[model samples]
Target: MTAIATVTHVDLATVQDGGRRGLAGIGVPISGAWHRSRYLVATNLVRGAEDPRQPAVELLAGSMELHFHLPTTVAVVGPAQVTVDGLPFGAGVGLAVTADVRVVVDHRGPGPVYLAIAGWEAPLVLGSAATDTFSGIAGTSLRSGVALTGVAGSGCSAGAFLRQGDDAGGPLRVVPCEDVPLPVGPWRVQSTARSGTRMVGGAASSSGSRPSRPVVVGAIQAAPSGELIILGPDGGLTGGYPIVGVVCSADLPRVSELEPGEEISLQPMDVPAAMQAFAVAERERRVVHPGVLGRDGSRRGSVPDDVAPAK
Candidate 1:
């Protein structure tokens, strides 16, 4: 493997790809990047296209430093102050560097920051490079002196999307799980991890343990302890607690960006609305890299010739 860069410093980061999908039956979580939109934006800024399977550094919090072994281009997306070789550089754009150059990112924020190298490669496990925080599956602990392998960068133009927080600042839309309605109020985020985001002091009430049932990401479970646990990308496959609702895919990004002590509100909607909301949000996300072909070989947000576009 060709050494691309060496880690000099890092705080709570992981190599994540699209993650292991369709393995939940064998007991595996879809432990991939938390904020899909931001992750894609970072990849596009570096690679000129969004490949979910492409590995990127998922910086959760704090700063990181790296020394390049080879000349390459990289992109840092999200809220952060980035500097290369002691010179201040702007985030959300591709930055070219020479071998032995030092790059530093100071990111201590509520949401995650994505760092995508142009040709960075990661070892794949279960058809993915993502680290499962809860299960410790395919995990890589980033530390100093670690040599990362990748090819030379095929640089792209400066392109990225920086979405800091929920600019809408509205209630998170939720779809009731089965017939159980989720209690809605001003909920305060207590704690968060890749496994789940725990919130308390809402209208949510405690419930007795039910039979272990299938659970997916974004599931809102009402625990016996009276805390609401919203499952993250690395959350468990099945849960014993009562599931009151599931956060809509459109709003999952907001859930991923929740910080401790931050107020979160939930608004229940019907299944059709949830689906429509997701479709609409996905349509908007393609603007991050307009005209770039996605995995399916179609232009981002472009309607197929065979099918009618959504009204």
Candidate 2:
């Protein structure tokens, strides 16, 4: 109802909450934040809770600039350079902002970054605000000069600032299939989008033509040409290519951060190990500090390595 900020510039940014669930059977892609862990962190930084219902700004490419019209607080998660009124702040820390302030997020590289504002709101479509770039079903891409309106919350609370891990490197954990062997070779990442990630540098073990079957996020399919594809959040509901393996849920977020030309191997993991890994990740996200902001509107001492010191 009230204008809080306006987008001065953005490249491939979107308003995303939790994806539209339960509608995948109806031929809809569960398009949401590309990295779930990052999204949860961003949510907690601003609102003091990991409520997926609250929308956050997802920056997939390039940089973004926002001009605030009212006083509020914001937090950026993942890798990026965040500047408020020309003063630099690190990612994963809350910045109390005021009217006429300008916040800029510059894409550093590799993974996507998230921006969470206290009481940020967006128009919901079918119970979600996530934009499926492939289907365009729930939302649309953000562009320049778009005014963002939200009911600014009273304040933010002390939340966690997690230092990003080196998940992108190392062998990707997977639940392997005995029937279909995954193509071997430190596969090189070719490109990535919301739909899927294409990779090169693997041998093609021809699966021939088969019936198209249901596919889920993290499914790894192999083509006849030996190239591999990993399904992303907005991947198709069904796939026809032979499924060699499913990336373990714990490692799926790492897959999202894998950059082009990076070579990766697959490490087969059992169901129990995969579940344990996921639980460990969940627990790590719950760690919080007593405070995140100082009285002078500067981030407190508990800053992560990626965020620059406020100056």
Candidate 3:
């Protein structure tokens, strides 16, 4: 086995404005050149009052500094502060590390405070790295200097880990999960008109200009009006709602790229056609980036080619 490096320093810095901010304003900043390292040592309580449930951890937003021990890639999912060897860096940005690095997250607002270290090993149950905070199965909440492991065999050494640009804003795509029946086209999304719109395990209610109602996909279900909640990889095994449509597994990445108030259009697709589309998309993804190719070679964004719009 390769020699594992231990965390040298950790800090619970306050988040300032305009670091590495993400949707709902959460994230962190990374600095310095680190190599052959592992682990994101969280040393502070990073909090996000705006989104208390989906607190900003591991992600960066403001002038925070983080140190690393090896060549690593950092992805910011929420807003945070960042620093490198005591120097300030830009917010909402992803950093590639090639040597020992230091990061600081200065808290700006009242949100959950946590730090995420890269290059650790954790068991994989689903297709995602996020720990089921509720189930306590894969991951748990972060504390000061907490060293949470990463996905084993990830081999994510040097490359762009962020799917969307730091400032890239656009619509979110949704096909329905295993519950929905029909292949829905893209739909527009916006933040909840009012606050107190609870997000159960990252499951937020969809609003504004959604796809046709009553989308059905195998075991998933959806309601006609009110709110449409799409299940993510960490979603529960079964539910009660009538899943009207299902987002193809291949298109989940597209959904992740969506920001609030963005428009998404969905094209209907059947089971057989959906499967074929997935296969084609996978091939295309590999061709675009051969290094990231996995054994499965499955695609993770957009609808498959075979799936056509409902006439």
Candidate 4:
């Protein structure tokens, strides 16, 4: 068995007092104590997973500051105008971290950017490692000098990158609540101005005048109104909302691939037909992405090289 490396420190001078208090209050209440320390990487480099056992750390040189929210954000800070191997780094657009490499993030600016580090474990209570910024259920942001441990693999591919100003937009799929009336065609998702909405049995609450409804992934019930909702992993376990429709389990991956603001059309199906479709989809997924399953039928943290990227 591999022992996970522990985080030793985090610096918090850049964050405001109110932010520190909020992060501490929520973090302590849930995690029992703050565990890991954070440091700013001076280089533009950020590393994800090197191995299932090793924890990833961001190294920022002087003059750079990081802003992050844990359970919300984790920030890292360091000196300004540092160099990685005598080369300039952190010139505006930051670099993505690759596995097994250490890079530096240096800044020429006078103020510091924030960097945060924490243990990454799967099976987070919510769908994300981030705490709900509104709920106060977890730490809202990262503080300097906090120690952490047990970070897990991010499971992202090597050399994969995300660029600033590049928007990955698409519609989120949701199943209709049992009690709510279904909508017809592709209904647009309205933005709720408020934050920190709580979810009950897979449904979310909105500060808006209308009642918040549960979101699930499934087809709409055969009714005068043909509507559907697609549920994400954070959906509540149970609810009073009627689930007239559900997105087929097979379509979940496709749904996951959608960018924000993209629309998905729903084709209705009865329960039995839905089940059959799910079965076929599962089989096909296994065949296409055999790396998804390890030899023991368990999930693998790193995908096998043999598997092709989704077309």
Computed on alpha carbons, the lDDT of every model, listed in order, comes to: 0.78, 0.79, 0.33, 0.30
lDDT for model 3: 0.33
- Give, for candidate 4, the lowest lDDT window spanning 10 residues: 31-40
Model 4's TM-score against the true structure: 0.35
lDDT of 4 by residue, 200-293 (tens): 1222222122333433323222322222234333223233334545655544434323323434444454557657855764343222211233
The deviation in Å at residue 230 for candidate 4 is 4.5
Q: Between the candidate structures 1 and 3, which one is better when assessed by TM-score?
A: 1
Better of 2 and 3 by lDDT: 2
lDDT of 4: 0.30
Error of 4 at 155 (Å): 12
- Judging by lDDT, tell me the better candidate of 1 and 3: 1
Clashing pairs in 1: none
User: Highest TM-score: which candidate?
Assistant: 2
lDDT head-to-head 1 vs 4, winner: 1
Give the distance in Å from residue 137's predicted Cα in candidate 1 to where it truly belongs. 1.9
Residue runs of model 4 more than 4 Å from their true location after superposition: 1-100, 103-148, 151-184, 191-231, 235-244, 253-260, 285-306, 309-311
